[model samples]
Target: MGWVSRLSTVIRTQVNDWVGAVEDPEVRLDQAIADLQMELLQLRQSVAQAIATQKRTERQRGQHQTWAVEWYNRAHLALVKGEEALAREALSQRQSYLTLMAKMDDYLGQQRQVVEQLKGTMRTLEQQIAEARTRRDLFKARARSAEASQRLHTLMAEVGDRVTGGVFDSMEDRVLDLEAQAAALTELSQMQPTVSLTSQDSRETTASVEAELTVMKTRLGQG
Candidate 1:
C-alpha cells in the first residue's frame, strides 16, 4: 500500500511537472487580460444602454408633464368660458398624464441607478486590467529567470560525469598538456639559429673553400 501510494505520488508529480513545463505564463496572462477587457467592454455597453433608457424615460416623463400642464390650461380655458362639463373632462385628462409621468420618473430613477452600477463595474474591471498588465511583466521576468535556472540545473545535474571519466580532471590535464606543448615549441624556436637550413650545401661548400684558401696561403708563406 505504501509503495502504491508512493507510485501514485510520483505519477502525479511527474504530470504536474510536465504541465508546468508546457504552460505558457505569458499566454495565460494575455488571455486573462483579454477576458477582462471583454468584460469591461460588456459593462460599458451595459452602462450605455442603461443611460439611454434613463434618458428616454426622462424625456417621456417631461413630455407627459408638459401634456398635463396643457390639459390644466385647457381646463382653465373651459372654466373661463363657463363650460363646467368640459372643465371636468380636461382635469380628468390632466390626472392621467400626471400618473404616467410619475411612473416614468420611477423608471428613470431605477435606470440611472443601473447605469451607475454598471459604470462602477466597468471601473473595477479597468483597474484589474491595469494591475494584470503590471503583473504580466513581472511574471514574464520570473519565467525567464526560471528558465535560466533550469538550464543551469540541467548542465550541473551529472554528479557522476566528473568521476566516471575524470571529465573535469581530464579537461584540466588536456589544457595543461596543450600549454606545455606550446611552451616547448616556443623554446625550441627560440634556441634555433636564424640560419637557412635550405642552403645546407652552400654553407658546406663555402666552409670547404675557405679551408683550402687558408692552406694555400700557408704553403705560399712556407715556400
Candidate 2:
C-alpha cells in the first residue's frame, strides 16, 4: 500500500510537470502584462479624479476669498459712517468668512496631499508597467530564439538518424554504380576492332573449341 501511494504521487508529479511544459510562457507573460496595464489604467483614472478634486477646491477657495474681500469693504464703510452696531455686524459677517476660510484651508490642504500621493502612485505604476513591457519583449525574444534552436537541434537529430540508417550508403552505392557504368562505357568506346571475323576465321575458332574438348577428355581419362 505504501509503494502504491508513492507510485501515484510520482505519477501525479510527472503529469503536472508535463502540463507545465505544455503551457507556453509567452502567453502567461502577455496575460500578466495585460493585468498590469489594467491596473495602471485604473490608477490613471484615480489620478484624474484627484486632479479634478484639487481644481474644485481651488475654485471654492477663490470664491471664498472674494466674499471675504467684499465683507471687509462693508465693515470699513460702516466704521466711516460712525455706526458702531453696523460696524460690529459687518465684522461678524467677516468672522464667518474667516471661519469658513480656516475650514476650507485645512480641507484643501488634505486634498492637496491626496492629489500628490495619487500622482506619485500613478508615476510608480507607470514605471512598473514600462518595466513589465520591456521584460515581456525580452522574454518573448528569448523564447523565440530558444524555439528556433530547438527546431535546429531536432533537424540535426533527424539528419543523424538518416545517416545512421544508411541513406547516404544507398547514395554512395548509386554513385559507385554510375562510375562503373561510365568506366564500362569508356572501355567499350576505346575498343576499336580493326579486323572482322570472316568464314575462315569462324572455322579456325571451331577447330580451337574441338582442341580444347580433346584436351579435357584426355585429362578426365584417369577418372
Candidate 3:
C-alpha cells in the first residue's frame, strides 16, 4: 500500500510537469505582464485616492489656520473694547484652532512622504513594464524565427523522403530513356550505307559493258 501510494504520487507529479511543459511560454509571459499591469493600475488608483485625501487634509488644515487668525483678530478687538472675558474666550478658540493646525501639519508631512513613496513605486513599475515589453518582443521574434526554421526543416525532410521513394528515381529513369533513344538513333544512322550519283553511274557502265561482251561471245561462236 505504501508503494502504491508513492507510485500514484510520482505519476501525478510527472503528469503535472508534462502539462506545465506543454504550456506556451509566450501565453504565460503575456499573462504575467497583464497581471503586473493590473497591479500597477490598482496602485495608481490607490495613489490617486491617497493624493485626494492629502489635498483634502491640506484644505482642512488651511481652513483651520484661517479660523485661528480670525479668532486672534477678534480677541484683539475685544481687548481694545475693554471686554476682558470675551477676549479670553476668543483667545481660547484661537488656541484650539492652533492645536488642530499643529496636528494637521504633522499628518501632512506624513502624507507627503507616503505620496512620494507611491509615486516612486509607480515609476519603478512603469520602467519594469517597459523592459518586460521589450524582452517580450525579442523573445517572440526568436520564437517565430525558430518556428520558421523548424517548418523549413520539416519540408526539406518530406522532400527528401519523396525523392528517395519516387520522384528522383522516376526523373532519372526518364532521362536514361531519352539518352538510350538518342544513342539508338545515332547507331542506326551510322549503320546505314550512303550511295552517290557517281557510284550509280559506274555501276550502270559496268553492267552495259558486261552485256556487250556477252553478245560478242555469242556471235563469235561457230554456227
Candidate 4:
C-alpha cells in the first residue's frame, strides 16, 4: 500500500510537470502562423524579383535580336556597294549579335523555368499560409473554450471547498452549540417547577407538624 501510494504520488508529479511544460496552444499557434506569414512574405519578394529578372532578360534578348537584324541590313548594303571587307565586318558583327541572342534565348528559357518554379512555390506557400490561418483560428477557439471550462471548474471546486471545509464545519459546530444551550434551558425550566413544588410541600409539612404539637400540648393541658 505504501509503495502504491508512492507510485501514485510520482505519477501525479510527473503529470503536473508535463502539464506545466506544455506550451499554450493559442500562443504557439499564433507564433507558428506568424512565422509562416513571414516566410510567405519573403517568398513573395523572391518571386517578384525573379519575375522582374525574367522580364529584364526578355527585354535584353529582344534588343540583341534587333541589333542582329540591323547588322544584317548593314551587311547587305555594304555588299551592294561592292565593299567586301566592310560587308564581312558587318556580317561578323551580325553573327556576334546572333550568338548573344542565342545565349539570351537559353538564359531566358532557364529564367522562365525559374520564374515558373518560384510562382508555383509561392502558390504552395500561400496555400500553406491559408491552412495555417485556419488551424490557428480553430485552435484559438478551442483554447478559449478549454480555458473557460477550466475557470468554471475551478470556481465550482472553490465553492465546493468552501461548503465542505472549515466554514461548513464551523456552522455545524454553531448549530450543535445552539441545540445544547436550548436543551440546558429546557432542563432548567423543567427543574424549576419541581423545586417550587418541593418547597411548598416542606412548608405545609412544617405547619401541619407545629399545629399537631400545639394540639398535643393542649390535650395534655400543658398549653
Which candidate number maximizes lDDT? 3
RMSD of each: 9.0, 11.5, 9.3, 7.6
List runs of model 2 lying over 4 Å from the truth: 1-23, 196-223
Q: Which is better, 2 or 4, measured by TM-score?
A: 2
Q: Write candidate 2's Cα lDDT for 97-211 as tens digits.
A: 8788889899889988988898898889888888988988887777567556655555555555566666788999999999999999988776644244366688899999999
Model 1 agreement with the true structure over 120-170: per-residue lDDT tens digits: 888888989999999898877877776666544444443333344456778
State every prediction's TM-score relative to the real structure.
Answer: 0.62, 0.74, 0.76, 0.62
Model 4, runs deviating above 4 Å: 1-23, 161-223
Model 2 has an lDDT value of 0.78
Backbone clashes in each candidate structure, one number apiece? 0, 0, 0, 0
Residue pairs in collision within model 4: none
Can you give the lDDT of residue 95 in candidate 2?
Answer: 85
C-alpha lDDT of all candidate models, in order: 0.79, 0.78, 0.83, 0.81
Better of 2 and 4 by lDDT: 4
**Residue pairs clashing, model 3:** none
lDDT of 4: 0.81
